[model samples]
Target: MFAVTILGNNSAIPTLDRHPTAQVVTCNEQLLLVDCGEGTQLQITQYRIRRSKLRYIFISHLHGDHYFGLIGLINTLNLMGRTEPLSVYAPPELEQIIQLQLDCSGTILKFELSFVPLLPGYSGLILEDKDLRVSCFPTQHRISCFGFSIEMQKRKRKLIPEQAKAYEIPAAYFSKLQEGADYQRKDGSIIKNDWVTLSPGKAKRYVYCADTIYDVNLLPWLKDADMMYHETTYLHDLEDRAAERYHSTTVQAASLAAAAGVKKLLIGHFSSKYTELQPFLDESRPVFANTDIAEEGVSYIV
Candidate 1:
C-alpha cells in the first residue's frame, strides 16, 4: 500500500509533544524518508519502520528543522551494516556538509552513498521507480527550498473476466488480459485487447509542501493531489509573522489545498509557542473539509 507516516510534525524548536519536520513515504516494499529532522531515527524505531527497507532520503532544504538528523541517520545506517546503495536528494551543499562530517569522524560508509543535487530554482522529475515517481519544485522560503510530489502509478489494466469468457477466451489466458494483450481463440480470430480490458485507474499522489510561504504558483504541481502536506507554522491570528518568516498559516494552507481540489490536506510545522493544535484544525476545516493535523507517530494512507 502507498502511504505516508508523520515522524516529526512540529516547526522550529523541538518539544516533548512536537518535533521538527520529518515523514516516511511508503511505496510498496520501499520506504522513503521525506525529511530527516532531529530524533527522526528514534521515531523510526518507535514506529516500527524497517530501516533496511529505506532506499531514498529527501531533504527539502538545509534548515536544521528539516535535516539536522540526516548525518546521524546516515551514520546509523552504516553502523547497522546496511550494504544497499542509498541515494539522497537534496540541495547540492548537503552532500559536501555530510561528507565533511563523515570525513572528520574518520568513518567509512559500508554502502554506496549517492547524492542527486536539487538545484536552486530548477524543478522537474527527480526519481522514477517501478511503483512510484517523485519530483521536486521550488518553495518560497528564506533559503533555497523545495517540495516533493510522490505519485503511485497504476500499472495493471483492469481485467474483465466475463467479457473475456464471452469471447471464448480461455481462463488460462486471463493474465494476458490484465496485461492488455490480445487473445487468440480456437476459431483463429484475434480478440481486440480493448474489448476485454479497461485502462488502469488514475494514480494516487502525495504532495509535501516542505516549508513555504503562501504561494499560489504551486498550484500546477499540486493539482488534484490525493493528499497534500502544507506547513502551517502559525494560527490565522499570526498570519503576519508567518508571512515574514516565509511560513504559512492554517488558513493559507487550507485555501491552497481547496483551490487545487486536493483530496485531503495535512497541516503541520506548528510553532513551538503553541501547545494546543485544535485551533489549526478549526481554522482549516472550514476552508477545506478534509483537513487534518499532521500528527506525529500517525500514518495517513494516500
Candidate 2:
C-alpha cells in the first residue's frame, strides 16, 4: 500500500476537468494528505479513500490552490465524529489562518487537531516514525514553499528460510529471526543472526516538489529517489513565462528528474490553459525515459 494517489494536479485555477494541488501518500495502513486545495474533500470521496485512515496533512504553502480546502476537510472530519487526533505540518502562517476560520465559526473540533509549523527557508528532517521518515527542503517559488521527501522504512530484515531450517531453527522463531534476533539451539550453541538474515533492501523514497521554479538546488534531496513529482506548469516553449512566474516548465521538471537519476518522474501541477496532458509525457520522456503524467485518481506505487 505504499504509493501516492493524485487527487488534484492543476495550478492556481480550478477547471471543470482539473482541480488544484492535492495528493495522498499512502504508507502501509497510514494515509497522509499532502495538500488540501479546493474540492479536496469531494475528491477524497470520489476516489473512495477511507477518511478514517487519514492521520496526517501536509500543506506545502499557504497558497489558496494549495490549502484553501483545509478548513473544510478539518470540519468534515469533525462532523463525521473522528475522535482520533490529526496532525498538520505546514508553513507557520497556516496555523493562524486555520484558527481564525474555526474561531469565527465558533466550531470546536471533536478531535484533537495539532499543527506543526514549518519555518520559512527551513530544511532538514521534520518527522520520523516506526514506518516512515519525512524531511522538508526549500524550493524556488513565488512564495515561501517547501518540498517533502518521504521514505518508507523497511524495518524487517531479509530472512533466509532455507538457511534457518538447515540450522535447525524452529518455525516459531522465524519472526524473531526476521527482526535480527539470534537463535540459541538446545545444546546452548548460538546461531548468529547474520547467518540466516541479510540487511533489508534500500528504502523506497518519494519526493514531492511542491510549486517551484526551475532550480537545481533540489537535486541533493531528489537524487536516486524511487519516484519524484515535479510541477510542470507550462510547455517547453513557455520557458520564459514559467521563469517569470516562478513556476517550472515541462523541460525543466524532466531535466531535473534526469539529473537526479530518479527511478521514475511524475510531472503534474499543470497550468489551466493546457487541456491536453499527453504532451507533458511526450516532452518529458525524451529527457527522462521513465516520466509519466500525474493524472488525478491514479495511484503511483512507490
Candidate 3:
C-alpha cells in the first residue's frame, strides 16, 4: 500500500487547470504530505485523501510554491478538530515563517505541532516509523532544497506453515517465527529461523526530487528506486531558459532517470507557459522509456 498521489503538479504559478507542487505519500494507513503548495488542503479533499491520517509534512525549500499552503492547511486541521500531533520537516527558516503567520492570525492549534529543521546540505535518514523510512538529500536549486527518499520497510519474514508444523513448532510460536526467531524444541533441538521462514523481500523505494537543476551527484539517491518523481519544468527546447531559472527540462530529467536506473520516472512541476502536457512526454519518453507524467490526483504505486 505504499504509493504517492500527485496533488498539484504544476510549477510556481497556479493556472486555471493546474496548481503548484504537492503530493501525498501513503505508507499503509499513514500519510505523509510532501510540499504543501497553495490550495493543497482543497486538493487533498478533492482527491478524497484521508487528511486525518496525515502524520508528517516535508517541505523542500522556502519557495512559496512549495510551502505556501502550510499555514492554511494547519489552520484547517485545527478548525476540523484534529487531535493527532503533526511533525514538519523543512529548512530552519520555515519555523519562523509559519510561527509568524500563526501569531498574526492569533490561531492556537488544537494539536501538537513539531518542527525538525533540515539544515543546509544535510543528508541521511530523517524519519523511521514501523512502516516507512525516509531520508533527505540536498538538490541543486536556487534555494537550499532537498529531495526525499522513502523506503517502505518489510519487517516480517514469510513463515512456512507446513515447515513449522513438520518441525513440531507450536502454533502459538508462529508469530515469533515470522519475526525471524529460531525455535527450541522440548528435546532442546534448535530449528534455525531459515528452516521455517524466508527473509523479507527487498524494500520498495520512492524518491522525490524536488525542484533541481540537472545534477549527477543525485545518482546515489536515485539509483534503483522503484519509482521517482523529478521535476521537468520546461521542454527540451527551453534548456537555456530552464538553466537560467535553475530548473530542469524534460530531456534533462529523463536522461538522469535513465542514467540512475530507476524502475520508473514521474516528471512534473511543469511551467505555466505550457498549456498542453503532451510535448513533455513526447520529449522525455525517448530518453527514458518508463517515464510518466505526474498527473494530479493519480496515485502511482511504489
Best by TM-score: 2
Better of 1 and 2 by TM-score: 2
- What do the candidate models score in CA lDDT, each in turn? 0.94, 0.93, 0.95
Best by lDDT: 3
Give the C-alpha lDDT of model 1.
0.94
List TM-scores for all candidates, in order: 0.96, 0.98, 0.96
* TM-score of candidate 1 versus the correct structure, residues matched by position: 0.96
Higher-scoring candidate on lDDT, 2 or 3? 3
lDDT of 2 by residue, 143-170 (tens): 8999999999998999998999999999
**Candidate 1 residue lDDT tens string, 49-110:** 99999999999999998999899899999999999999999999999999999999999999
Q: Please tell me which model should have the higher TM-score, number 2 or number 3.
A: 2
Pull out the clashing pairs in model 3: none
